[model samples]
Target: MHAIIQSLCTLWRPSWQGMVMGELKYRRGGGSGGPYKVAASGRRIVRVSASSEAGERMDLLLFPAAGFAGGARAGEAGAPWHRFSADEVRRYSASLGDHNEIHQSERPIVSGFQIAEAMGALEGDRDFRIRFHYPIRSDEMVSLRKEGKAIYGVTDVLCFIWEAL
Candidate 1:
C-alpha cells in the first residue's frame, strides 16, 4: 500500500479574513518530475497524523501537519521539504480556534502533513473540492526507505464536499 502525505497549513492574512492553503507532494522510485498544484475547498477531507505526547488525543494527529515530512526524497522527483515550525503551528491554531497547550506551550512540536477530511462544511454558499496525487509534500530531506513502486503511488483521489446555508 502507498502512503499518503500532506503539507503544512499555510495562511495568508492580509486583512480581517484569513485564507488557508496546503500542498501535496510525492514521488516514486526512478522518476524526475515536479510538484503539482492542488486546489481545495471547505468540503475536502485530508487524512493527516503526527506524533503525540502524553494526554494528547490521537485525533489531533489528523491535522495537515501531522504526517511524514513532505518533499523530494533522494533519487526521487521534485525538491526537498521544509517541516513546519512551532510558530507556524501556533499561528494556524490561533486562526483556526485551536488553543491546545501542546501547540502553545514552550515546547518542541512535531511538523509535517497527513491525510484527513475537512472537519466542517464551507462557511458560505460556495463549495468546492480538489484532489491531486503525487509527491504529497515539498522539502529538502525525504526518507529513501519509503520510496518504491508499490510504496509510492497514487492510491485514491479523495473527494470532499461542503454545503452552506
Candidate 2:
C-alpha cells in the first residue's frame, strides 16, 4: 500500500467502519486506472480498486452513515485543532460575490470552494476535488485539520473532505 493510502486509512480509522484499499493500475490511454468498484459485501463498506480494463477509474467509499455515524474524528480530540467559523465562511463568500443561500444563510454552510481555496492552496488552484459528507454549518465552530494531502472540517461529525484531485 502507498503511504498516502496508509495515511488516509489512519485518518478514517477512527470513524469510518470499513477498509481502504487501492490498486495502482494504468488505463489504455496511458493514465492510472482506478476508483472502480471491487465488489462489496455490505453497505457498511464498498470496495474501490483499479480496473485492469477501463475508461475512467472511480474510487470511493460508502459508509453506514454520514462520516461513518456523523461526528468528529476521534483523532481530533484534545489540544485544540484549528477552527473555521460561520463568520469566516460568510465573509469569504461575500468577498467572492457568491451570495448563494448555502453560503449566505444566517447559519450558513461554509463554501466548499472557499475551503478548497484556503486549505488546498498547496495543491494549486482548480487542482483538487472536495467531497462534503455533512454540511459545514457557519453558525457552529468546527475544527479543521490536515492529514496527508486531505483537509477535513468537522463539528460534532465529519463534515467535508478537501483533497487533491
Candidate 3:
C-alpha cells in the first residue's frame, strides 16, 4: 500500500526513529483518561478515553489533532494531575504539523510523538509501543510516572504509556 511505502520512506525522520506501536481504544461508555485525543470532533466534550480502563466513561466520536477554538472540558481525576499550559500544547502541535479539530476540541492535547520525545525515547530506539486512552488538553493538568523503560501518562480515568519492546 502507498501508506506503507510512505511510512517506510519517512522512517528516517526524527519522529519515526523509534519503532513505536500502540492502540487507542474507545469503550463508548467507558473512560481511561489518557492523552489520546478523543475520536470525536466538536466544540464540546463529555467523557475521556484511556489506554486502559482508568475510568469508565468513553464519549469518543470526533478525534482531532489540533487547531480549533472553544472552551475546554474539565478533566477527570484519580491520580494527581499537573497543569499543562495551553501555550505548551499549542506550540508543540504547530511544530508537529497536526492541525485537526479533534486534537483541539476545547483544550490542546500533547501528541503521542511529543510525549514519546519528552520521555527521551523517541529517537534511536529499537522498538516502542505508545498507547493512548484519553486526551490531555493543553490547559489541563496531567500525570505521568516513569518506571524503568516505560513512561505512563496518567489521568484520573485514563492512562497512556510508552514502552520499549
What's the TM-score of each model vs. the native?
A: 0.25, 0.44, 0.44
Ranking by TM-score: 3, 2, 1
Those runs of model 3 whose alpha carbons end farther than 4 Å from true positions after fitting are: 1-82, 104-106, 121-126, 146-149
Model 3, residue 36: displacement in angstroms? Answer: 25
Worst 10 residues of 2 by lDDT: 18-27
* Tens digits of per-residue lDDT for model 1, 1-165: 011122123321122121112332222223221232223233233333221122111111122332223433224323222344556556545654433344454542322122222211112212122222222222213221223222221212111111121
Error of 2 at 60 (Å): 16
1-165: candidate 3 lDDT, tens digit per residue: 112112222222232221222342222224323333223222322122323233322222222322122323324333444566767766665555555433444565555445544544333523355565555556555666666776666654354665665
Error of 2 at 165 (Å): 3.2
| Candidate 2 backbone collisions, by pair | 35-58, 35-59, 71-156, 71-157, 72-156, 72-157, 86-138
The list of candidate 1 runs beyond 4 A from truth reads 1-80, 111-146, 149-165
Instruction: Provide the global lDDT of candidate 1 against the true structure.
Output: 0.27
How far residue 144's Cα lies from its native spot in candidate 3, in Å, is: 2.6
lDDT string for model 2 (84-125, tens) is 577887787666555355566567656544554455444443
RMSD of 3: 13.6
Candidate 2 TM-score, C-alpha based: 0.44
**Cand. 3 Cα-lDDT:** 0.42
